[model samples]
Target: MRVSLILLFVSFRSISGFSQEAEEKKWSSDFSLELEVENQYFSNKGAYANQLQNFLSGAIKPKYNLQSADGKHLFKVELFFRSSLNDPNRTHFDVREAYYRYNKKSWSVSVGFKKVFWGVTESNHLVDVINQADQVESFDGEEKLGQPMVQFNYPTKIGDFEFYYLPAARRRQFPSDKGRYRFPVAIAREDIPFVNDLKEWHPSFAVRWSKSFGNVDTGLSHFYGVSRDPLYLGFNPATGLDLSYPVINQSGLNLQYTKDAWQFKLESIYRTTERQSFVAAVAGFEYTFGNIRSSGVDLGVVSEYLYDSRGLLTFSGLDDDVFIGARIALNDVKSTELLMGGIVDRTKGTQLYRMEGSRRLGEAWKVAVMANLLNEVSPKEILSNFRTDNLIQLRVSRFF
Candidate 1:
């Protein structure tokens, strides 16, 4: 990664040799900023110390991009910082995207930190494994930390191919003692353990081929190297306990079929490690009722099933579960939308309910609302730690 950075600086520092030198050498830049302030309201008291009922947080995200006239070379940089008045772990910074891309007629190469997503399911993402989860930001796993990698894209008549060389894996952050949805014991963050002596500097590789056939889209991917999910190593006398990131190989498949007002999606993965192997999948379908009563309102119903072969030992506690949800789009000038969903464990009858909605206040202002509720969490389940962590979030964003 260091070598790649050095080469990137040396190559991109000079703009004279980027093109044939005959065309007019032109470069343009764009800058944007978003300011966000949010609050969380918990219905019940926390299970641990320092957990509050109401927490306030704010964040700033700024991005800048530069590109040539012919769109052959491009540069982008984005930064994020959040400050919390209650929890220290919620205050963090991330370099979401700081990458340079060189594009040709048939191929493109990108290097540096960037975000990548891969999955077709609405409830759970079993195939998206490139970036680490930014757990401190959101518990739904929708937010992600940017990953440092070198990506290459090739397009052919059959399919589009992508190759990735990922390095410098980011460790997943946990809530502090003062934060919400915390574990029983505090885990030390410094000097964490990793198998195979690779640590965070392990070099990983991935390849994906995607193609669309008629009304169906498909993607086949394979990843070899470090696993983003951590396994519990054991209790320490001083630090309590820690997690170990092991080396693994995972192959995944994502499929989606769309016909009229119906959509079917599937995402599955087969993963193997030195000690264990397992398969996890999420499959579902969505049906939409468009232009109901000519009111320009669209309503959709969703249902999906989740399964993991690890059973009780599964860290996700989703061994046999089902997700049911609905979506509403107002189709108004304000661009309002709402989504509500719940995941139910078939074995223990526990459930997690979530609802999220957003509406534009005007051209440059927007407001969003989210709520998460837990019900009947069993002690044998992993989500028992969050039984009393049901909370609601309200966020307002100003764009400039």
Candidate 2:
């Protein structure tokens, strides 16, 4: 954290010579803050009936931006803070984005920490491994902890190339036993073990190439270093039954083709470790009916097929399953949207139902609703631990 702060200060000072407008504006930088309140209600306490049914939390996000008048240098920082009334593990803070980017004619360089999302499928993001999961924040893995890194990008006729050098990786967060949706055994954060010498400060590297061919957009990338997915060794003398990460090499590909109202997407990854290796893929499509008979309402159908070689042993428990969902866009002034989806296991007869809807209230306020339900979760699958932890989330936000 000290290194990150030093780099940020140095970069900010380097650009001060060119930003004459910044001097004229004095301290009047572009700044904004968003405040949000959320309530999570669980259908049941938990598997052991020792969890909180209702959790209330509030968060604030503040952002600051500075740019040179020539548009060559940009700096931005975003901070996140959350406090929960019920669960202690749910209260945390993160620096989601704090980076300085310099853009030249043919290439760019970015330093510090940021979030990079790289996938086309809605059901899953198999290729997004740059940031670690903030599991205490969300169950779907949408919440990500920032990674400290140095990034480089260069565009060419054949393709656009990007590279990353991650100095350190963050550990995955887990909810406590008193929190809903927790695993049977909560993870211990102190004095954890690593599978090899690739410890927390070990360097990680990744390279990606992306380009468009007609209607298809494709990205191919490779990473070699400490993996984001951890191997949970049971309570024992060697591992102390804690979270241990292994060194790994992963190759990923994401592709999307858009033809009129139809979009076809696919993402796949092949990863190898000292002990094991596997392949996983997600393929899906979305077809939309636009301007439904001049009503300005668009309806879309989404479906995806997820496959994992490990079957029920996989962490996601989405092996050989199908996801079917609908997306509705009201194209109205309030900008209302709704999404509902379900995943069904082909071999185990396990199912998960989910829905989310959000609407803007005037220009400053927004209201959103989300719900998740699990049915017939078999003990053979890993998701059986969350069978009784179905949840509904109500969230409201105000933007300054």
Candidate 3:
């Protein structure tokens, strides 16, 4: 792997030199950097927090752009590195995006690692958002995919429709505390062929089309792939085998409308495999004040719903059968952004809400104090079924 990476670097450098010398002029570039910090807490310590008492993390990301001296060709790359403040196995580096493009008049093609989410919903817990997929990582995490892929776009009267192909890729997997596998199992020596032959390759692909009518945007996408790695089927230690499942085959549709300070979004996805199948959907809305005095005085609210029939709740049981919640933010008032919300369980009627307040310390930094109260109302199983926890976080974010 190291040798291949070195060779790739060398090859790109050589090509760049030749192009630089042959072309009449050279290209210019731009750069930017961003940083974040977060602190978090969990309700079910047994399920959510298996490591220490709480979790904290920080990340620094940088992006670079390259363009031809004649301003015709464009190349861009992005990298993100995250480090756990206390957890042992939570540190990792990732290539968020690395793609290049040549702009003409009407068409463009991007090839390499890129960010593509299929929804416009606020409660993206049901859809995929590379940057903010997981709620627990709201302060300092991302759900990014890095693959060798190609995407082409063409503009029509309505909007731009895109076609994408991923010839081969190895998607990153995040393992939960219960039993998560970060990498594929190695072919044991006993199972190896007598001639020492091993196969290690995977392919994945996707196609999507989107269009907008007035302020409404709608899209549909499909994805299919076969991977040599083992999918998280289920946990079974009795057979000395981590469950193995087939590749991913899925499809989804997204619809959204944004106009006059009002926004609405909807997303639905269906994932099927030999082991199980599940369908998830999310609906959300937000209304801002167009004539508000301060950016902080605007009104904000978001809600989400989720359902999974695959019987596997990701991120622990936290991704349970259903979730409904709301968020409200009051800006510039007492220099605070008060966010209060709750999520309820359908079967048990258990609920949780937030008692948190965040204030900006400066242009690039903010501090928050929060309390997650479980079963705020008087309940029968207050102690056993419900409890409360407090979380305090001071975040300093900088953009360049």
Candidate 4:
């Protein structure tokens, strides 16, 4: 922390020495703050292993962007405060991003925590932020892991590439705690390991390339990293385990084309380990027309399909199912988008569908709601494996 402050001071001093301009502008620095709130209910809270019930989770974030007059140096910092009403253990306050960059026309180097996003899509909520995504894809095999690091990037005629040397979290094996409940009931909890020697020890490397022609854009990205030693798990006895998981590797391809009011996008990723691999893909399209069309209305449709290899769910106690879903966007009601989707399990004959929608209240705020229903339709399966039949969630966000 002290070193970072020193670096920040030194960088500013160096920037102040550059040739001054005739005029200075306050707008050269930008700052913004935002808040997000979520209200939710879980009918099968029991199914999720006694998780949160109806509750609200919220986060407050502020960010600052600073640039030197010469444009050769740039700095960014963001702080976040998040809390959950039902799950207090999930509360956190930290520096989400803090980085300094040395910039050139074709290349740049950044040191500290940074976010690198790939793909060409109007809304990349899922694809952005490579460091924090799906648990199956971003594994610590442990508890909390991730943050910033020293990263370098270079762009060529063909594509752009980046590398990061980060301190990764250690992976730990989770144990189960079982006990007898009221008269014949059984309750079990996941026991995670916690070790003292654990340090920020994971490092990563990533590369991405994009090419565009006419109205179409396509790109590919790959990331690889190895596990660090003396990793920390959640439980107290975190040592004595060999960090022998396969070196994590992942790669993906994405394509998007837009001509006038119509757009199409496709994205796919393959996650590989020493013993097995998994794949996920989504294809979507949208068409916007209105206002000038005179009716003051716009309409669009989106669809996606997902397939999870059976191996990915083995240790997670999750379902290996195929999912298909679609969404409808209606501009008349303040950019309201409705989503509906379902996942089917081949082995269990169980099916689950989720319904969700979002609407913009203004330029800076939005609200979203979601509901889920799950059922088993085939060979009267035992409910012992089932936890809940429905769930509901509502969220509101203010963005800067």
Candidate 5:
């Protein structure tokens, strides 16, 4: 925590200095702030393991950007803060991204904490391993903690290559004792363990090559480092049951093809550890009907198959599953959109349904609704633990 604070202070100082210098040189500088309020409700009553019930949370995000006159150098900082009525884990702060970047003709370098996303599928982000997931913030793993690193990128005729040297690792955060979506056995912060002797300071590295050919965009990546997903090892002599994040090497590939109103996507990864190795993949396609019947509405159908070599023993809960969904876009002034989807576990007859809708309330306000339902979840399935956690969420955001 102290190291994070020190780095954050240094980043802020550097941003301030760059902003002043850029202002003196009349370079472009921008700033913005946004606020959001959210309410969540769970359908089932709390069990002995459950914590909070209904909750209200609010967040604020502030951003600052500075660019050099020649556009060769840039600095950006984004800060996040959220407070919740019941969940202590949700009432926290984060430095989402703070980086200094230098770009030249065909190469670029960046230093500081940042977020990197690498995936092509919508249901699961199998290739995104650089940043730790902020699990307490979202169940879908959409929220990520910024990772401290130095990155370099080079573009060539063949493809674009990128490399990263991460100096530290951030542990995945869990919900507090009073937070929703928690495991039956609460994961105390102090009980989390790392396989590496050097712990958080252990260095990690990754490289990727991406290219586009006609309508196809593809990327191949290799990551050698600590696994972001922790393994729940039952009962330790000292700390009771503990969670361990193992060191791992992973190779990933993601591909997307866009042709007319059809889009196809694939993401796959092969990972190895000292004790085990596994392979996982997700392949899917989406077909859209644009301006259907001249009503200025677009509808899309999506289907995907998820496979894991570990089968029922996999922790991902996506092994041997099928996902199907639909998306509707009003294409109106408010930019309304709705998505409904479900995943079916073929082996156990378990299914999970989800719905999400969003539309702009005004020029500065946006409202969104989301719901999740679990049905016929088998005890052998991982999602059975969450069967009682079916929930509905509503969010409103205001932009400045």
Candidate 6:
């Protein structure tokens, strides 16, 4: 991996020719840097530690574009590196997007490591399975690890079709023993089991078709590969909790329709594995009131229903739950935003509430605050393990 990364960087430098002379041109390479500091405090004591922990991280993202004078052949490279103090695995680097492409009037092909987003639901992503979740970076699974694949896209009169060939998989990272947000028992990374004898080398395939008509957009996709969400085999006498990744075949659909101030969204998936077959879905709608109270602020109300057939066996705490949230966006120069939401498990009467806000400071700096509260948790539910992990977090970031 280290050698491949080194080669990727060397190739980028060679292709871009980022000398002083190249910078004088109209289409030269670009680079940027960002630094971030995160502090988290758990409201309740855990088996690990007490009050506060700090994570100082930095990222250097550089982008280079190679284009012919007529713009027929295009190549692009984007790199990202983030290192943190609290989690050892978080202190790592990744190639976010490095691809070479040839674009024509109706079709394109790209080969490299990239990130693909494929879902519309705000509460839970039921169809976004192309990239692995960067579990150690955030609790909400918003961050994703880069995927290495070859992609082909063709636009037809009715819709667009995309096909992918994923050569290998990247295992999700877990927090260290000292990290704050962790399972009750530490996860042994080496103990993770895979159904394939080749393990991470097992290849995966996917195809997606999407299109938009009038105010409605829809997508249908299928994936055959190792499941991104592993199945837990409960507590093991020797390995704590045994987690295994099973090979699965999943078919998914996502749709969004916009009508005036209202937006409707739905994401559903049916997956089958050797041990289990289940259906899961998130259906939601959002209503936005533009220029609320004649002010520049906009308010949005979001409501969603989450369902999973696995019920108690589902790893997602959202099974058989309802989510309601509000979003406030200040259409100011600072681009400030706030989102507050809660997920209530109807069966267990447990709820997880979250509040997040972010605002820009000056031009290059930004700050974000978030809080998570778990209430009325039941021992029979998966969230019971995280009952004591409820916490508030603050992050400051500076961009160059």
Q: If scored against the real structure, what TM-score would every candidate get?
A: 0.93, 0.93, 0.70, 0.67, 0.95, 0.92
- Model 1 spans with C-alpha error above 4 angstroms: 1-24, 232-242
Q: Which 10-residue window in model 5 sums to the lowest lDDT?
A: 232-241
Q: lDDT: which is higher, 2 or 5?
A: 5
lDDT of 4 by residue, 255-293 (tens): 888988777887776766665566655566666554536
lDDT of 2 at 68: 64
Candidate 5 local lDDT, 201-258, one digit each (tens) = 8889999999999999999999998888876433457764455778899999999999
Q: What would the per-residue lDDT of candidate 1 be over residues 1-400, giving only the tens digit for each residue?
A: 3543554465446433544542557677788999999999998988987778888999999997879888998888787889999878889888777788999999999988889999899888889999988888988777888788899999999999999999777777877877777777644454456687767788899999999999999999999988887764344577664467888899999999999999999999999988889999999999999999999999999999999987766666787999999999999999999999999999889999999999999899999999999999988776787789999999999999
Regions more than 4 Å wrong, model 2: 1-21, 24-29, 190-192, 232-243
lDDT of 2 by residue, 1-400 (tens): 4655666577567546546767764423588999999999998767764587899999999987887666677788887889999988889888787888889999999998788888889988889989988888998889898788899999999999999999887777777767876666665544345566656888889999999999999999999888886754334665444456788899999999999999999999998887778899999999999999999999999999999886755777887999999999999998999999999999898999999999999999999999999999988877887889899999999999
- The 0-to-1 C-alpha lDDT of every candidate, in the order given, reads 0.85, 0.85, 0.54, 0.54, 0.86, 0.81
Q: List the candidate 3 regions with Cα displacement exceeding 4 Å.
A: 1-26, 35-50, 54-58, 69-71, 125-142, 169-200, 226-245, 259-261, 290-296, 311-340, 350-392, 398-400
Ranking by TM-score: 5, 2, 1, 6, 3, 4
Q: What is the Cα-based lDDT of residue 148 in candidate 6?
A: 79
Per-candidate total of colliding backbone pairs: 0, 1, 4, 11, 1, 0
The predicted structure with the larger lDDT, 1 or 6, is 1
What TM-score does structure 5 among the candidates reach?
A: 0.95
